[model samples]
Each structure stands twice: as structure tokens, then as C-alpha cells.
Target: MAGAMMLALADGGSFTLEWTHSVEREDWRETWEVTEDHRLHLTEAAVKGSGAGMEPGPGGHFEDGWWVWAPDLPPVPALTLAASGETPSAWTLCGEDCTQLGATSGQPVQVAPCPDAG
Candidate 1:
């Protein structure tokens, strides 16, 4: 499967990210690619979890920057990610207790600064 995220640029030149992942077809591992003015590419692959819903609990991990997980689900406010997964069509992140985070598409998944990186 394939998905994309749009990067809004001030110069009018937008950045785009493309990703592909699959469980059955190992031919294409879960990976993300970015393209923009700066010439750089990431070849490493990461397992894009294939699951759904939150697990509920304590602290967790998350990526940086302001993000919107799902516009359809309830708002989660500012917090850490407890669990995350990719469905057949979209990416989702949730707090430790698996509270609802709105549906996010064509946009950043974790907008706030990533906690795991720090």
C-alpha cells in the first residue's frame, strides 16, 4: 500500500513524502521517502504496524511537530503516543491509554516535537 504527506512551504515549493508497506508481500517493506529542495533520501525501512485502536495505559513514544492523527475520531489534546498502527488506508497514533486522536491524512501525523527523539 502507498500513502503520502504534504509539507507546506513558504516559498510556494511544497515538500512531499511517500511511503509503502505490506505484510504479505515482503518485496516492499514498510518505508518512508521524502523529496524536497534539499537532496536527501532515507533507504532504511521501519515496520509500519498493521493494527488499530488504542491499548490504554501509561507513557509511550511519539514523533515531533504538530500533528493530526484522525479527523474522524475524538480529539486527544497534547500528549504522548501509547500505540500506533497503519490501516489499509491511513496512519493512526494514540496516547498510552489509547484515547482518540482525530484522523489525519495528507498531513503530518505527529506535529509536536517528538518525545522519543528527545
Candidate 2:
């Protein structure tokens, strides 16, 4: 993530990334936290309804009109969300403050924990 945008963690080092699925047109959300090692830890995820590429993970259950589950994937260095510029709404990053991003065409947003400077 060198030379990319750097965002300090919020008080609890937790945040959520939200966006509308392009094919499903359904709202999707992923809750993540910054680990002490400066890696991104995805804790949970939810989607309005299942569709192409919207399959819920095993053990997912219905709750409040959403299919929610905890993905068992390992921590990632970073996550990238591509922008088509045709989305009705901007991708949202919510922590201490909410930021709308990647609404422009050809612009992509990459999210990662701020790594320690050496």
C-alpha cells in the first residue's frame, strides 16, 4: 500500500465498507477491523438477498431481512473496490466518519490498515 492513500484507524480500529451490488442491486456490507499487525480483518458480512455472486456463506441465517454471515477467510493486506461510475450511489466507508467514494468513472478505491512507518 506504499504511496497510496493512508487512513488512520478510528478509535476502535473498526469500520464498515458498504456498496450496492451491481448485478443484484442489493445493499451489501462488510464489517472490518484493523489488527495490531496493521492487517485488515473482516469480521462479518451481510446482503439484502442472494443473487449472482451474492451467495451467503455456510451457517448464514436470515435476520432483519438480510442474510448475514461471518466469512472464515484470512486477513488481507488490502481490499480494492472498482468503480464503474454508473452506480446510483457512492461506496461508503464508515468509521468515526462516513465517507462517500469511488463515484467517478475509472477511479478505484483501495482500503487497508495504515501500516507502521519504518
Candidate 3:
């Protein structure tokens, strides 16, 4: 299982969400940056062991009202979610096949692609 962390800017202008998984004594972290406009940016993704493999990827653009990050890595998969306003009343995390892996409501939002997702 993975754990999630969130940090909102002091001015409430930006926020970051991160997820971490432990592997071989190393922690792989996936992070997302949310701009004031509600645009989500993939700041860092991939394994964090030695802090060498983690590289920032071109984040997704705002579409409709959601921030969508397409799968760049095979196991990473893809992701989509609400971009603005208060925490979503409900949201879903889908796999590469678009299968729902998890869903939640009224909580700190933390989302990532399927595997090795950032």
C-alpha cells in the first residue's frame, strides 16, 4: 500500500500532493502541483531511490474542468480528475484499461497514474 501527503501554500494559491511507496528500502514518490487556476502539473514522478531516477515530465493541460495526465510510462498508466473548487464531492482513479482502482469524496485529493505513476 502507498501513503499520501498534501501541502497547501500559505496563500492558498498553490498546493502539492504526493504519494509514496517503499521498495527495497527506497521511497518512490509521485508528486503533483496544482496552480491557482486549478491546473495540475506533474512535477516529479518515478522511483526516488538515490534521488536519481526521478525526473519531471511535461504535465497535462487543462481540459474542460479536469486535469488529465496521460500515461507516459508503461506501468504508470494515466489519470484524470477535477481541477478546481473545493475538494471534489467524489472522484475516481482509473487504471490503464480505465478500470476504477479507487474512489473517494470530501478529502484531501491525491491522484497518480497506475504504476510508477507520478
Candidate 4:
């Protein structure tokens, strides 16, 4: 719960976060959805290339030029990301529209889901 943030989600809606590995120079992506209990659930993950320490998780397979898999993780109240301004590429968060998280460097960004108002 460090620096927690509460974000409202659309009913059964999902979001995507994409980033590039600093050393591997490959693209990584994760698809997350809001659970019924208003928590963040990681549904899928993909990597454009693999290297040392960049291998896909279990049950992963190459598809459409990317290694894709579903991460077997439990839903959580929030998700935290590192923002040390050290990575070669910045993080991109997309829902309705994609937005860069570059301005959040030097601190951590926490993402959580709030129950839909409807």
C-alpha cells in the first residue's frame, strides 16, 4: 500500500501497460482487468523478445512475434511500479487512450481500482 492510488474503472473494463526492457531492448506488455471486488487482476503478459532474465513465464508461447502468457497471480488491491528514470524507455498506460508515465519518475506509482459508480 505504498503511495496507494484509487482509480475508478468501467464495468468489466480492462487496461494495458506496456514498456521496453532496458537491457534486452524488447517490448513487454501486460493486460489487467478490474475484478468484481474492485481490485487489479493481471490477465496476460507478452514480451517481444527473450534474453537472460527476460524469459516468459510458465505456459508461455510465441505468437504473432511475441511471447504471450497468462500470469498465474492473485488479484491485489493495488499495483506499484518503479519510476527511477533509469530505463531507456518509459512506461505507457492505456485504457481509453495511451499515456506515458515519464513524469512520475523518482517516485513509485500505485494503481488500484475503485468500484464503478453505476
Candidate 5:
């Protein structure tokens, strides 16, 4: 399985993130919106399997500048976002087993193609 988080600067100084995971020939995507106050909102979630479901709750927050999102789903990667100079710009997707799928450093984010993806 592989996972990644794409970050972009939204209008009004907020941010938008799209977290995606590919496993078992299926893809799971979670869309989020971060406010200027650092509050995260789970705007939408979709999965190829009917067994997969996400519960929206207190979502996430920025800790010292890095945005952290920890959900109750197993095997789902954790999302973290950090800034380079002033704004939150970089992100990392860490699997539950501690495997890091991808990360970014200020430029356009890209998920390293997973050889095992299917």
C-alpha cells in the first residue's frame, strides 16, 4: 500500500489538503480544509470499498506550526504538514506501521510511485 498528502495554499490564507491511499486495487481519498486558526475540517471522504467509512469529529490542529491529523482508522497513514518560512507548505504521509510513503519540501508535492501498488 502507498499513501500521500497534497497540500496547497487556499484563498483567504487558509489551506487545502488531499490525502490519498492506494491498497488492494482500491483508492481512498480524504479531503480536508484548514482554517487560519489552524482548525481542520474533514470536508469529504471516499473509498472504493463499502467496508471503509470515516467518522468526522474533532479532526486536527496545528502543533507549533505542523498540522497533524490522527484518525481512528487502522493502517491509514497519519498526515503532517509543516512550513518552510512562514506558511505551512510541506507534508508527509506516515503509515500506521511506521512506513513513510512520501513527503514534500516547499515545491510541488509528488508521491513516489509505489511499485507494489495495484
Candidate 6:
């Protein structure tokens, strides 16, 4: 799952949403910690139901923060909210909604498509 997420992030124009469900007992104490390493630490927890939540980790940090939840939580397929590029193309955001930022494809594309052959 982590590898898949990394690939999505590499695109620099994608977002993911995950849902979870499980039983939560009173004794359950969920402690979702966001380490400086950018890895999610989903501590003790119990989903109980279709509980949905989204956490925005430290932004701008290419390698920082994470999202964590209890293991009991239901395995919700990751949702690709949006994926836009400089090219005028439609992206598949899956079930997740998307909002474009800035104007004119936003920033420039980093990589070049190698010299085109005539």
C-alpha cells in the first residue's frame, strides 16, 4: 500500500482518501501520531463502523507526516481525489472529489519528454 501511495504522490497531482470501520470498546484509546519522519503511527484503536476522517499532515515536507488509524478499522480502498497535469487532459480522481489550484496547469512540469524524433 505504501508503494502504491508513493507512486501516486510522485505524480504531484493526486490525492488519496481511505475509509475504515471496526468495533470500538470504551477501553480503546486511539493515538494517531505523526512522526517527523513522515510515517503514520496508528496506535491502539477500534473502527466500530463506517468512520471516515482525513488528516492533512505537515505540508511542503516532501518526506514528512502520515495518517494513522486503528487496525480494527474497515479497509477502505484509497480514493484518488484528483490528478491534474500541465497537459489539457482529464484525470481520474476515482470517487474522491478534486479542486484545481492556481491557473494554467498551475506550476511547470519538471521532467522533459526526451528529444522528439522527426
User: Which model scores highest in lDDT?
Assistant: 2
Candidate 5 whole-model C-alpha lDDT, 0 to 1: 0.36
Q: Over the stretch 9-116, how does candidate 2's per-residue lDDT look in tens digits? A: 832388889999987799999999887777888999999989999999988999999999999989888888887899866889998789887788865788877665
lDDT of 5 by residue, 40-105 (tens): 444544444332333222464444433344454332122443333333222323322222222433
How would you order the candidates by lDDT, starting with the best?
A: 2, 4, 5, 3, 6, 1
lDDT, candidate 4, 16-43, per-residue tens: 9999888898999999998777878899
Q: How does each model score on TM-score? A: 0.19, 0.86, 0.26, 0.84, 0.31, 0.18
| RMSD (CA, angstroms), candidate 3 | 15.7
lDDT of each: 0.26, 0.83, 0.35, 0.82, 0.36, 0.27
In angstroms, how far off is 35's CA in candidate 6?
Answer: 1.0
Query: What stretches of model 3 exceed 4 Å from their correct place?
Result: 1-7, 10-26, 49-118
Scanning candidate 3 in windows of ten residues, the lowest lDDT window is: 93-102
> Model 3 over residues 75-110: C-alpha lDDT tens digits?
222244433333322232222222222243323444
Error of 1 at 14 (Å): 14
How would you order the candidates by TM-score, starting with the best?
A: 2, 4, 5, 3, 1, 6
Q: Which structure is stronger by TM-score: 4 or 6?
A: 4
- Top TM-score prediction, candidate number: 2
Error of 3 at 2 (Å): 24
Residue 23 lDDT, candidate 2, scale 0-100: 74
Error of 1 at 76 (Å): 35
Off by over 4 Å in 2: 1-6, 10-12, 116-118
Q: Report the C-alpha lDDT of model 1 over 6-66, residue by residue, as the tens digit.
A: 2222211222222232332212121122233222232222222333332211232232321
**Candidate 6's residue-wise lDDT over 1-118, tens digit each?**
2312222222112232222212221111233332233333343332223223333233312122223343533322232222333333332222135433222433322211112211
Lowest lDDT 10-residue stretch of candidate 2: 3-12
RMSD of each: 16.2, 3.1, 15.7, 3.1, 16.0, 15.9
